[model samples]
Target: MESGLAGWVQTIGYIGIFAVVFAETGLLVGFALPGDSLLITVGILGAAGKLQLFPAITALFIGSFLGNNLGYWLGRWAGPGLQRRVRADHLERTQLFMRRFGALSLLVGPFIPIVRALVPFVCGTLRMPYGRFLPLTLLGSLIWTVGLTLFSYWVGSKIPNLEKYVYLILLVGISAGVVPAAIRFFRRRSARSVEM
Candidate 1:
């Protein structure tokens, strides 16, 4: 799955990067897509003279911003109905988190693959004011896309095994996101048990 996606991006170049990032963040089915890996690969390619770094990063920033906006609207349209039928505990947790730290979540969510895709939708469903959401979303998108792209570009420039290590970087990135969420989940569960 990883290599195939990388190959496709390699074949299509910057446009592919923009599309994949857009889809992964904007669309639900895109949750499984290799976003972090793709970004790293593109950065490596930029370093290799295969792609233009400036334009590619620019497109990535725009694509992510637009994708999150689309997701937010999509959530507004469909999230309410889905939220009603979903389990209550999950809903309560999401709502509580959103209420307490929505801006921070919006700012940081893009770096975490799963949360990247879902945060915009949830914010929309909860009717978060767009005025507040937009600035944070833009800032987060800028940081995640530009920061990773530049980091990978630097690594690719310095490393010989760009392809081999891109996956490792992605593994660390994914783990970074998952570990925190898992810790939170366990803490929440323990608190509930104590209350009981």
Candidate 2:
């Protein structure tokens, strides 16, 4: 069942991968998509010779960068009106993340799932200078796309018949990306309750 699922993912090809990455990073509706797992799977496929490594990496990077730009502009266009529509707690958390991290948040955001999608929009709403946002976002996208892809590729290449364990790899990748966010959320909730 797992191999079959991985096979299906491989069959989607580069364009499908690109679309997933683009929507996951750009659109608010994409929050639930498995961006990290997809990237790792792409890397493993590349190692298994099921996909071209260079083009896959290129497509992933382009999709992420462009998607972030789309989110930024959308936020800019919607302005404060968008903020009102968003859950107040989510907006507040995003704002606090930006405030605590400043510009570094753009670079780090790609590693955090929901934050990856929201930070650019928040920056846009705040009118972060394009000159600054562009390069940082570009760097972040590159680091995220290339780093995960290559690491997974390397692992696939090293392990004999690693493709058989794709599900395990995916589980690890998803956990790595999600566990920290969950911890942070629970901690924050506890802290808030203490205050109240």
Candidate 3:
């Protein structure tokens, strides 16, 4: 989970923001591209006068928008093919999430980490229409990017020393992200043990 590219990307300004956001949200190969880190890093850079907040936000917003659309297409084309080859955990989660969220899941899924990587595939498998998926997904990406970016900017302004403790903050952010899933996992484990 060490992000080697994060340092390089942080230095390149808007292009960096677009590339990272695009890959993380749209390409499965990019799930490790540091979505949260991008937000915080940009904010810190902005505070340090290396980047401007509005430009950073705009680039990320567009990147996120385009990436999700591309993901939906990849999902649509590759989804069923992948599903037919797997009858294991992937299939189970695929069915479960699809059953629960339907096509709208594509719109919500990009915000959810591991789930973010799978939504486009699910959308493809379900043959969800592109027109239906585009607007909502874009809206969601804008909100997610701007909100997190602004939050990071705000925190950076107050601290102004994020570069020194960025890793610590990332660790804390990661823990915060994992807590709910961890709680649910533990609860499931406990219930299973009790049943046995």
Candidate 4:
């Protein structure tokens, strides 16, 4: 699965990567896409000189920033009707996340998969000022894009023939990205069941 995904990334190149990032961040259906894993693969490839590091990073940032902007607008356009269609618990949790973190959720959301996809839209429905959303979104995009890409690139550069182990690396990245969220969801469900 990892090799196949990496191959797809390589086949798609910069524009494809941009589109994936945009959809993942902007579109509701994009939550299932492999955003983190793709970045790790891209960084590794860039280090291997199969892809250009700077261009890959730029694509990531642009896609994320624009995608988030689109999501916010979509939320505004769709309003509460869209929120009503979402699972009640998911909507509640996202609202809780926004309340708990305030503006910092924008910074943190980029690191979390489902939350990253939903935060901007939630912000829009809640009518968060665009002036405020823009800068935080920009900063979040920059940090996530640069931090992940450069770290993976450095790892790729230091380890000879790192591409051979790219699948393993992606497995770990996927696990790292997903496990905690799964655990949290289950724990919350268990707690709710116990309360009942």
Best by lDDT: 4
The runs of at least 3 residues in candidate 3 whose Cα sits more than 4 Å from the true structure, single-residue gaps closed, are 1-6, 83-107
Query: Which structure is stronger by TM-score: 3 or 4?
Result: 4
Q: Rank the candidates by lDDT, best first.
A: 4, 2, 1, 3
After best superposition, candidate 2 residue 34: deviation in angstroms?
Answer: 1.1
Candidate 4 least-lDDT 10 residues: 1-10
User: CA lDDT of each candidate?
Assistant: 0.78, 0.85, 0.72, 0.86
Better of 1 and 4 by lDDT: 4
Clashing residue pairs for model 2:
none
Report the number of the highest-TM-score candidate: 4
The candidate with the higher TM-score, 1 or 4, is 4
State each candidate's clash count: 0, 0, 2, 0
Q: In model 4, where do residues sit more than 4 Å from their true spots?
A: 1-3, 177-196
lDDT of 2 at 143: 96
lDDT tens digits, residue span 156-181, model 3: 88886565567788789889978987
Cα lDDT tens digits for candidate 1, 15-61: 77788788987875455787777778778877866678898899888
TM-scores for all predictions: 0.77, 0.87, 0.81, 0.89
RMSD of candidates 1 onward, in order: 3.6, 2.5, 3.5, 2.4
What's model 2's overall lDDT?
0.85
Give the poorly placed runs of model 1, Cα more than 4 Å off. Answer: 1-5, 82-100, 172-196
lDDT of 3 at 47: 71
